[model samples]
Target: MKDNKQSEKDSSADNVDEYLQTLGNEDARERRYYSQEQPFSADEMTRLVNEERLNALLAQSDAFLSSLNSEIKDFNDEC
Candidate 1:
């Protein structure tokens, strides 16, 4: 019947409107867009690791050299 078809169309339109309204919800709409992080490549990562290791070794060597200098100075002063 004509009435039954109209009722089905009305219910379908209402469902679509409800779905559209839900799209405005906070959970549905994020505050900001997500970004992907850039990771270093194999060669770049290895270079960074080596650079840090060399820097640490240099610092340790400098500290050892300073300790030896102080000890020599004390011995010379005593002599």
Candidate 2:
């Protein structure tokens, strides 16, 4: 019975490890793909890079705004 339990635990751990490894591989592939996608024009590439950065920044800003709004609501309730 103890051996069966240990085998099950080992199997679960292996599955989790495999999932993490798959994610790592996917990230690496994405990095390689992005790195190779050089636009025909320098300006175009610059624009594309800037757009990605802007989108990431916007997402961060949205998250911050949501947190701030939540905090303000909490403060208002306390008052």
Best by lDDT: 2
lDDT of the candidates, in the order given: 0.84, 0.94
Task: Show pairs that collide, candidate 2.
Answer: none
lDDT of 2: 0.94
Model 2 alpha-carbon drift over 4 Å, by segment: 41-79
Model 1 over residues 1-79: C-alpha lDDT tens digits? 9999999999999999888888766544553333344678999878778787789999999999999999999999999
Report model 2's TM-score to 2 decimal places.
0.51
- Residue-level lDDT of model 2, residues 24-52, one tens digit each, is 99999999999998647987777667787
TM-score of each: 0.39, 0.51
